[model samples]
Target chain A: MRYFNNPEALLRLVSSMQEGFAITLTIFFATLLFSIPLGMVIALLRMNRHRAVSVPVSLYILVMRGTPLMLQIFAIYFAVPMLTGHNLERMTATILAFSLNYAAYFAEIFRGGIMSIPVGQYEACRVLGMRRSQTFFYVVLPQVFKRVLLPVSNEVITLVKDTSLANVIAVGELFRAAKNEASRTASIEPLFVAGLFYLIMNGLVTLFFNRLTQRMSYYRD
Target chain B: MLEATHIRKSFGDTRVLKDVSLRVSRGEVVAIIGRSGSGKSTLLRCLNDLETVDGGEIRIGGQALVTMQAGQPVYKKDGERRALMLKMGMVFQSYHLFPHCSVLRNLTMPQKLVLGRGDGEAEAKARDLLAKVGLSDKAGAYPCQLSGGQCQRVAIARALCMDPDILCFDEPTSALDPQLTQEVLGVIRRLAQEKRTMIVVTHEMRFARDVADRVIYMEDGVVVQDGPAQEVLGDHRSDAIRAFAGE
Candidate 1:
């Protein structure tokens, strides 16, 4: 509480937390940039008729979803390098782990969205003389995105909090910086400040998704 | 012209179309009427290549869609099938009007993507067709925004924008109430007066009798009777057709 009365200490905490927040933002944005499209590809692979492709994808999804994300971070940061004889930088390991893990969740969400579309859409595209790829990209994906937007927004909001898990690998992101600040200053105020940052980031994400949903409201199911 | 000869199809153990053959010449409006599960819709689907025939042949404008070779049906190649489909258009019972797009886009997208028309040209043609269908005001609306009647009209205009040689409709009015049915059937009646070539599978006896030059009565997966509309619908000889026509 005394830390709140000290202007210099509060300014120091905000400035240091700002640097950590930048890394946190980078992780959040990079994970989304990589995972979303990769999730769509994995969803398509999961939907493939061939057992050889679908079976392995199913297993990958199972492992990713069933295991703890923190454990996955450790395995990627430590075990992967030991097993492969190639070391990944701490931030690289964190991003690789977060992206692949979230992609599994996004893939299932996408599959559900794609499957929810009525069969009539595909028939309409086919009768219109559109090839399969054209139908999927133009006719199907737009509708799928509309239907999946809410669920995807939920996953994306979860991703904001999940970025904190990167701290388990000692990457010195937001939460780790906050923890270090608290220990150094012998005060819990920095932890509360870190929670506020998460709340603000998630609030912005919610507002962004709400705007997207409104723009897409022109067409209903 | 469209010719479907000995078209046979089945779903698992149940046969939907059995040796069904039909011939429709240019500028003819043919209506196939029957009880549900009589394969009327399935025949229309086969013509559009929505369902591959288990055995038989279909030729559109003298181009073979499918032919029998070595005891199996050989369908046209992908490019050939696409080209053949370009010459035909279909409207479904559900209206299937790409619900995510505006009414104008539903008509214009296919023209731009399939026919390679420029965007302005496609939009101009779409506007014209929308006006013809009495929906020029609803061009900015989505299919979900329109009533069942209005959606069907948009669907019709969407199909016609392709400038196809033939148009197919599968129970277009089956999903509509009486007033909405009239709204759709009125559009069909006008198209018929314009001498457009169309093949429609309908449950509306009156629309079939009025708009079609040829009326085909189907029963148990085969064409039981086919003749001029006046002769067949007015002076039908089959018991099934009489019961269905409510005579």
Candidate 2:
């Protein structure tokens, strides 16, 4: 209470946590950057009619989705280092784990979106003499993005909170910084401020996705 | 303009088309009519390469799209096949327009992408076809914003924008109510009067009798009757054909 009550002290505390907040944002953006496209590729491969291509992708998705994300983080950070006789940087390990886990979930969502498009759409493109690539990029993918926006928005919100899980491995993200400050000052004020940070970040995320959804509402499947 | 001979297709163990054959000269309108499981649609699909015939030869616009090689059907190389297929356009039972695109864009995008037409040319042709289908005012509307009949008309205009030599409709009015069906049939009727080559797979008995120069009736995966429309639908036909005609 005494620490938070002092304006200078509160300012110092917030400034100190800024580095950790940036790290959290970095994790969030990096995970999404790698995961979204990777998920699309995986989803396409999963839909392949041949077993040789699809079987391994389905198993990979199963393992990634069936296991706990924290355990995945631990394995990538600790177990990989031990098995390879080399250490991964904490941030690299954390981002890698987060990207891989989120990609599995995104893959499933994309699969549903792609599958929901009717066969007639493909036939229409086919008889029009459009190439397969043209059919996918122009005719199919835009509709897919519209259909999967709600589920994708849900996953994005979950990702904002999931960034805090980095603290389990001492990655010193915003939540970890606030945890350290709370202990140092023997006050819960820092923890509440951390909660505020997460809320504000998630609020911005919600706003961005809501605007996207609104822009696309003009078209319907 | 189109010739298919000895077309045979099967799904697993069930034969959907067994030795079906048809030929259409330029400026011909052929209506393929039959009961639900009689493979009428399958034969039309085979012509358009929507369904590959297990064994057959298909020639469109005097170019071979597929030929019987040994015991199986072998399609032409991809580039050649696509160019040949571009001479034909297909409209589905359900209007499968790109819902995200306006009616004008739906008609123009394929021309730009597939034919490499300039935007000016594509848009000009799109507007012309839209007017032809009585949809000039609805150019900016999305498919979902239009009624069933309006959407079907837009689909016809979209297919026409490509300047296909033979237009194929797979039960174009099966998904429409009678009123909506007439609006679509009216567009087809106008196209027929202009002497556009077309093949329609439909259940509309009167439309087939009136509009189709030749009617090919299918039953149990084989051509049961094939002749001039009036001759087949008029007197001197089998009881099966009479019963199918509902008289």
Candidate 3:
């Protein structure tokens, strides 16, 4: 409560945390940008008829989902360096680990969405003389995106919080900064401020997704 | 013109089409009628390359779609097959309109993507086809927002937008009620008046009798009767056709 007595100190705490918050935003955006499209490709590969192709994709998903994110972060940041003899920057390792892990979950979500689409859509596309790629990209992807929006949003919101796990490898994101500030000032107020930042970010994300779902409500199966 | 000769198709050990053959001249409307699982739909599907024939030759506009190669029916390459398929259009029993797209887009996208039409041209053609099908007012609406009849009309317009040389309908009104079926059959009748080449696989014998110049009856995967609509439906000699006509 005494921390509120000094508005200047609070302002300084917020301003200092800006750099850490920027890193968190970077990880969040980069993970989403890479994971979503990568997830689509992974889903297509997983759906392949040849067992040779799908088996490897299945194994990848199993391993990524079965392991803990914290361990994956450590493995990417530390174990990768030990194995390859090239040290990955902490931020790079964090983004890579998060993208790969999240892509697996998103891939399954996409697969379910894509499969749920009635087979009639594909037959219609074929009879229209649309190419296989056209059928997927034009006729199929939009519906799949609409169908998987809720689940994808769930992963995205979780990702906003998951970015904090990057601190295991010393990536200076928002939570790490808040923890440092709280200890240095010997007060828990900075932690509360950090929580406020997360809530606001997630609030915006939810609003955007809700708007998207509404826009797509014009069509139903 | 469309020609499918001696077509043979089987699903596993169960043969669906056995030595089915038919030909349609330009601007001809042929109706295929049969019982369920009698291969009426299967035969129409083969003409559009929706289902491959185990043995047969399918030629569209004098272009070979499928040819006999070493005792098997070999389809043309993908590019060639696509070009051939473009010459013919199909409307399905379920309509199968892209549910996520507006009625206008259902007609326009295929034109733009497959036919390489410009946006303005595609839209213009789509609007014209919509008007033809009497669904111009529903252009901006999604298929899911339309009734079964409206969806089928939109589907017909979608196929017409491609400017195909032939059109195929796989039970275009099988899913519609009596009133809705009338709306859809009206559109087909209009197309028939315009001399659009169409092959409809239908169970509506009355509509088939009225709209189709030729009627082909199928039973157990073979053509049991093929003749003028009046001769086949009105005075059919086949017992299966009599039974199917509910005589």
Global Cα lDDT for candidate 1: 0.92
Best-to-worst ranking by TM-score: 1, 2, 3
Give the alpha carbon lDDT tens digit for every residue of B1-247 in model 3.
Answer: 8888999999999999999999999889999999999999999888888888999999899999999989988889999888878898899989888988889999999989998999999999999889988888999998888899999999999988888899999998889999999999999999999998999999998898898999999999999999989988876456778888788
Who is ahead in TM-score, 1 or 2? 1
Residue B247 lDDT in candidate 2: 79
- Residue B247: error of model 1 in Å? 4.2
Tens digits of per-residue lDDT for model 1, B160-240? 988889999999998999999999999999999999999999998878888899999999998889999887777645677
Worst 10 contiguous positions by lDDT, candidate 3 chain A: A1-10
lDDT of 3 by residue, A1-221 (tens): 74668899889999999999999999999999999989999999999999999999999999999999999999999999899999999999999999999999999999999999899899999988899999999999999989999999999999999999998888999999999999988999989999999999999999999999999898887
> Which candidate's lDDT is highest?
2
* Candidates 2 and 3, the one with greater lDDT: 2
Over 4 Å off, model 3: A1-12, A185-189
How high is the TM-score of chain B in model 2? 0.98
Please state every model's RMSD to the true fold in angstroms: 1.4, 1.7, 2.0
Candidate 1, which segments miss by more than 4 Å at Cα? A5-7
Under CAPRI classification, how is model 2 graded? high
* Docking level for model 1: high
CA lDDT, every model vs. true structure: 0.92, 0.93, 0.92
Tens digits of per-residue lDDT, candidate 2, A166-214, equal 9999999999999999998899998888889989988999999899999
